[model samples]
Target: MKATELRHLLEAALPEAAHAEQSDLQLGHMYLPAGHIKAVALSRPVVVGDRGSGKSFWLKSLVDDTRRQLIGKTFQQEELLSCEVKTGFSPDVDGDYPTPKDLARLVQDGLSPDAIWYAVMVHLIVPESLPGNLVFWKDRISWIQEQSETVTAKLRAKNAELHAKKQCILIAFDGLDRLSPSWRDTVALVRGLLQTQLEFGRYSQLRTKAFIRPDMLASPEVRQFPDASKLLSLAVKLEWEAIDLYGLLWQYLANSSIPSQSAAFRKFADKVAKLSWDEGSNGVFVLTQAVRHDENRQEQLFHQIAGENLGRGKKSGNTWTWLPKHLSDAHGYTSPRSFLVALRFAAVDSNKRKFAGKEFALHTSSLKSGVSEASKVRRHELEENFPWIGDVLKPLKGLGLPARKQDVVIKWKKAETLSSLLAHHEPVPLPEAIKETDPASILAALEQLGLCRLLSDGRIDFPDIVRVDAGMTRKGGIPVR
Candidate 1:
């Protein structure tokens, strides 16, 4: 296919957003990362990921009946096929569980988060024989603790029943970040939920998956409890590599809405990367471990679309390497969401600018523009989760990257950045659960959110992923007016 034809195909091939859409999920188009099979195992209790990672997306997928089975089949986990998945926590409030409002109220009332979560799951498992007047969270938690033997007996019987039929009940928890506004409360809640998961470990068929952010998992407050190490042992990080991102791209391309678009890319994939993605019975393309892990093969596949390098001269960076590097955060992790958004925008730019004269479908300049757009989308995502980011980052817009750490700190002090974060985001949780209000503390929070990089030599640098959209400048970076 010519550059123009391929760009058109790309426009139809890629999804507009990085997050999992119900349409995409129902249509069986999710690119299950092979490397993440272990991280997403039903037995794993704690799932951790950084910002813009697909934690929320997976939370939704696992709770959705159809997609959950699809994940099981893709990962070849037999138990997941017949397993019953329950939503123990999420943004959407269910009648079975307490809302964030209820949890906040209950926490303030001195009810343990462990009791609340365990009660929530117990009610989900066996709703009968519970208090009819347990309309309040405190009352429900009190009931669970008071009737501990009754609840465990009921759970044990249910587990035995399910085990007989080759089924398991996996309670999936997510959105602990929104459990409470206070950092102390969030950690306590997270720790309690994790402790509850530990308590459920005795039963073979009773499992819990608590999807949490890495920072929450790392907090000393959360890991302070006894046997917390067991929960930590069950934890896994949903990290994506350059090749995995490419594999995800191919999954979308192979399952494009337009049949010919799908065929065109899959044909090229087979020809170039020696990749043959089989269409599983579940109506999605499946990738093998060999293709998923083969960096060289994946590079060849990507090079066909965007070419080998950004420039013709030997000194320029390779497009395959440069794309992810530009899209990666300071922690060296590339979110799949940002990855897809960059390519989709690049294709749009390629078509609009008539920049298809190059040998590849996407031109170098257009890819850079793609990174800019992706950065903007990523920042919007961060703002949704942490509203204070825009205010803190706004004053530093036009600041040069890789400057001395003291220099950035001085600017933050003059702008009163820490005070702004406090004064703003009234009910919203502090950015990345920051406890320290000092300028240095605020800067560290920014780094935790993957907004900036602290150099070994006391210099502070911004990764191109965020720097571009944050309006920060770096030497030889993409030009922005």
Candidate 2:
């Protein structure tokens, strides 16, 4: 096919239906049906997960559903209010670097309190009675800026008017790590006054729900709150179950109509679901679900699917292993953003094949030049087989490395070592890459500076994201010591 024609086909080939509308476009288009959104919103659960998991997508799903109500749609008032938080925090800030309360206040001063309150109230209180109260509040909006203690009480009291009309309110604080350096302080401030604020909103009728990362959950600052766990209505850890993942991938296949769904959808759909769930063997692929077997099915399945098996010509018998219960039990997927990242990476691998009968073909030779008859691959074994190699290949992506049509491939092709590649490591200037002193002295200096390391194999490696995604184009590359 012509280049333009091929590009168009690839774009058209994406699975749009698998994702919900109004979701982050990167998430393969997941749409939570209105009912699911309503249920999850009302649940007011504490969602936890890793760095790349899909927690953001889940929170966004709720936000999108709640936002829909303001546009004249008929959604349950209680349900609409279940996912809203009244906290003065802005969702726009990075979770790792959130704007401080005093700072947020200053930035928000230009916007009317009633406007912000309206969003908070609508998502955490009854909407039917809001119109008249909203108008009244708007008229008296200037009173919100007053410094008097009574003013804060008065605002809380007015919020109470809406609280009287509802049973509960849900306010979700997502993206904790995305905040400013004061992330721990921010969590402490929110938790310290949470009940008072809830009580303030109690007259306003609402509660707070925080979606957190595993690391954040263990913070003494947040743990110091005596009723922290109680205040959090439900604690859900989101890990990918084989079935959940299968459902996702199946939906993607159906939506993409790659070679038309009739070609491979039905046969693989049930099989994939069955294999993923493995009802016969108890596993905790989805963290929320109960185990089927007393054995630790979790690690077995995770190891099997995560590519923990084969790497660089060494095939361990344990390669086709399961996810250990300890891994899930430990991480809890409190922050789902990390999990989503892994899935998206997996999706990239799954879609590369043109199907033949029951098997799917993978393009590995495309990973390097002048190599033909690249290995045929399977989805079930990818994640388990080559965990580190998977990390390297995921960013390079497409037959492009081996062929063309690559994503981010051009940026990585020049490095002598994957670890030293510019895409994987920021290009240090000549002055920086080299030091006037001896190379050994430079290595010693870098070690002291915490800038670089020598791996056991005698190759240099940096201890960050940049080095993780880099690779060397040369064969039998040097190892760091």
Pick by lDDT: which candidate is best? 1
- Looking at model 1, report the run of 10 residues with the lowest lDDT sum: 19-28
Would you estimate the TM-scores of all the predictions?
Answer: 0.90, 0.44
lDDT of 2: 0.35
- Which regions of candidate 1 fall more than 4 Å away from where they truly are? 17-27, 92-95, 108-110, 131-139, 181-185, 288-290, 354-359, 422-425, 428-438
Cα error, residue 414 of model 1, in Å, equals 2.3
How many clashing residue pairs are found in candidate 2?
92
**Model 2: how far is 31 from its true place, Å?**
6.9
Candidate 2 TM-score, true structure as reference: 0.44
* Clash number for each model: 0, 92
Query: Which residue pairs show backbone clashes in model 1?
Result: none
Candidate 1 per-residue C-alpha lDDT over 354-421 given as tens digits, one digit per residue, 9 for 90 to 100: 44345678888889998998888788877766678887788778888788877787887889877777
Per-residue lDDT tens digits for candidate 2, residues 25-141, read 422234222323333444444666543345555555445543334311323444464334333243642221224453245224553322333334332343342334543332333
